[model samples]
Target: MSAENELLLIMERISDLTATDAEIAQFNAWCDGFKAQEIQVENFDAVSERVLLQVHRRINKKPNVFLPLYMKLGAAVAVAVFIFSVWFFSSRVKSIEEIRYAADIAPGRTGATLTLGSGKKVNIGLATAGDLAMESGVKISKNASGDIIYTIMPDNKVTADAVNTLETSRGQQTQVQLPDGSRIFLNAASSLTYPASFANKKERRISLSGEGYFEIAKDKAHPFIVDTRGQELKVLGTHFNINAYSTEAVSKTTLLEGSIVVSTATSQQILTPGTELINNGSSLQVKQVDTELAIAWKNNLFLFDNEELGTIMRQVERWYDVEVIFVDGISKERFGGGVSRFDSVSKLLKSLQATGKVQFQIKGRKIYVTK
Candidate 1:
């Protein structure tokens, strides 16, 4: 790795945490290099090269973009020195809490609302353990830890008509154990609708909106179906993630463990492990993608692989329940790295600001972006 790139990685990895043994050794080695005046911070992560085109025009991305935080500091005086001090000081410290602004926002939490077919809305965050309600031949309740669970009832009036919806708003997320035993992790501003029981159903089908990671239960006789937006996915049993947020410019369906067939109005394509099917309005496109990045939210991490700023902000807006306004219009810089999603919003923004091209101003619930 280039010395500059290594410094970029070292700076970010040190900010949020205590490093591992290998990381400590790496940090020590960098310190040795700096003693010999070898720490030239120019062109950090290739930031000296400018990216001024619209991000959408460059949808085809690099296969692997693991560069850490970036910043430009070429004799620009203040910006570089001040940011370098922060990065260097933070790196030396064992652990420093995230830098806080005059006003800061917290990360999204685990919570959602359950809407019965009868229109009854039960707030999962405010709910207690025990059975909330019974429908069709199933009982819905929360465990001792307040996790949602579905149990088959003795008189399971298993019918296709008993449907329920689990929805999450901004700043909240949720997971549900479907009647068929499939588990789905729903992201912020997303919802999943499924039947109460699948005892007599021909197929285990669910409707989704926004983004979700699905671990489908296998039943050769009953194929699992996930219908979202204008596309449909069919899989006997598999693990996959679907990003169909309406605000996003494209819909991504990535398979991790099994096979799935995604069907649109005009064409149908089958996706195997490590492949993604993208529906970008007019046509469906398939590509080899990093599956982990596709489901990073499900794993409590924000992984960006040369992703556009607009795309990154949409995720931030959904998770923190804030508005991202680009006063100078959207930036075209591509972000590449990974960070814990549970940290305070400023930490994330700081990482982004390290890119040196973009800056952020947080006012109340709004984040004003500038270049």
Candidate 2:
């Protein structure tokens, strides 16, 4: 085939349809040739320009076949230039917003709730961990592991009830124990809501946000249920983790110790230990996974196994309570490793930099990414 036809074929493969692996490989090779020529432009602009012009002339001989390819090539080159410029310049002068966005929060951040069971809102955040304080006769205490535990006094009875939830902002995490003996470790940027009393015997339910690990006290008599982002998780009593962060494209429910029934508006799946249910907006898929990886956040660790840069940043944004600024091209890089959530944002970036493909800058709570 002629050079013009080959260029037209590659452009058609990229623009009109999903490119096959072979075609994509060819296109990448072409891109590399352009990149090589670009490197010499600083020292020999005229020579580089002449070479590009000659190539363009040869490829443009067949206007009917080459017009689309020319447009696509132009777009691709523009995108490449934009990506390089952003990464090259932003790395030199870091901003506070960039740093703040990069830091991930360590687990066990301060969190508490205001119980307004009797028309009064109590400040539970200030209450010491494991110390039981009485607010209108409702006993509230922190557990040995810094989880908030609530117990209603046997004699205390009220008609009106309200639970004001306290959640760790991005970059924070906390644990809590329900009145029913169930334990919950809330992930960063997560919240949980429950009533002051178990008042109902048929079922126990709570609302959740972001992500959390749960160890439900087996009460076969009363099935425990979690409501999160339009999904429901039901179990008689079991251990599991639910990640329902609104920012995420999917809601994940991973079973650790017991069986779980996960249901959305249109689908349902029964998940066993070592199995995970992922509900994207359109469909649900259940697959087996390493239970340890799913619960790593509970242990103050950030684990990634071939995870994309965007996914990794979401975890960082939640833990450190920061924002992420992708001022450059979206990173197509995938990473696999484990890092302590306790590390500073800069430290985490340094670890990622070891890969030698991507670099980051942390200014305060923001993180800026470049390549």
Number of backbone clashes in candidate 1:
3
Model 2, position 65: C-alpha lDDT score? 42
Off by over 4 Å in 2: 1-108, 112-115, 118-125, 130-137, 155-160
Residue pairs clashing, model 1:
70-354, 137-156, 137-157
Q: Candidate 2 at residue 247, lDDT? A: 88
Most accurate candidate by TM-score:
1
Worst 10 residues of 2 by lDDT: 39-48
Can you tell me which runs of candidate 1 are displaced by over 4 Å? 1-100
Model 2, position 323: C-alpha lDDT score: 74
Q: What is the lDDT of residue 132 in candidate 2?
A: 56
TM-score of each: 0.73, 0.68
Clashes of 2: 25
**Candidate 1, 139: how far from true, in Å?**
0.8
Q: Across residues 288-339, which tens digit of lDDT does each residue of candidate 2 receive?
A: 9998888999988888888888988888777777778886877989998887
